[model samples]
Target: MANRHGPCMEKKCSWCCDPVKVPANFSDEKIPLDKEGKRIWRDREEIVVPESQMETVRLKTFDCDLLDTQTGKCSDYENRPEICRNTSCVDEKSTKSVDEQHRETLEEELIPLKGKK
Candidate 1:
């Protein structure tokens, strides 16, 4: 996962810790459930990538246990996983504002709608 977008330099950034897409074989039981016992992943299906090896799509995400919601920082920054060390929020999408992101998403959705007869 070469981050051509560069390293994550934003202060108080918890985007990486928010939701991680796991393998398709990952157990649903491991996913955290809300108080209503509903699956916690609100939008896991938004992004699905094809895994040729497994011949399936990987499209599930969950909050990392190490994330401190109040502070939006990792509990153990020094001992974070290698994946974390390699992650950065300098990408185009991560740099956009919430409203910009929403607009982009709506525009993306409308593309298919416009294509439809």
Candidate 2:
């Protein structure tokens, strides 16, 4: 389910701009769920961009592997991965602020880059 409050108020979320890998078969009709009615987990690959290739990495991208770049929206909003559906910056109860959480998550998932010019 997409955010009930509507599209995120933040300009954009880092995760949406650079999503992690998803299963090829991901879709609303075929989402994998566990016996407890929870979505199944899949391993995610790190997104790495060498310092030399920084220019090649698009910032504020909407071209996530699973998103519709033109609209800057998830291609499969109804059946998007649980993580995508659950993360929300607008929810005040959230411990870490949106920027903080996003940065932490990106740091963990994005591989360390080498020397920069």
Candidate 3:
């Protein structure tokens, strides 16, 4: 890929690249962390959801193999899978955890697009 230059790339955001879905009860501290304190999700660890069968919602997750941990970017973006291409980095879900100031900035950036068909 010749650097598509999407917003995500410009900001170097890679939050969704590593999708970990633990049970709601699982504590954040329990997640393994790297030396830099970044969460290191277990490879294909099966979590048990409450009030459901043991394997009701088993999420087999691990960081993408192509991700460049140092740069927080995909090494092979041009060859990224369909699922990656379909994800939206600008969605509410993606920004919910961002700090208020950044969120406000994002909202301001989007103001012009509001009410557009």
Per TM-score, the best of the predicted structures is 3
Q: Write the per-residue lDDT of candidate 3 for residues 4-109, one digit (tens) a residue.
A: 3234554665555644333334565665454576664544443323233333443334555567878778777666655566555344555354354344433432
Residue pairs of candidate 1 with colliding backbone atoms? none
lDDT, each prediction = 0.50, 0.45, 0.48
Compared to the true structure, candidate 3 yields what TM-score? 0.41
TM-score of each: 0.40, 0.34, 0.41
Q: Among all windows of ten consecutive residues in candidate 2, which has the lowest summed lDDT?
A: 57-66
* Model 1 lDDT, full chain set: 0.50
For residue 53, give model 1's deviation from the true position in Å.
Answer: 21
Best lDDT among the predictions, by candidate number:
1
Q: In candidate 1, what are the lDDT values of residues 1-117, reduced to their tens digit?
A: 333443332334455556555554667675655457665444444344423323334444556666677877777666656566655534455767644543443243111112211
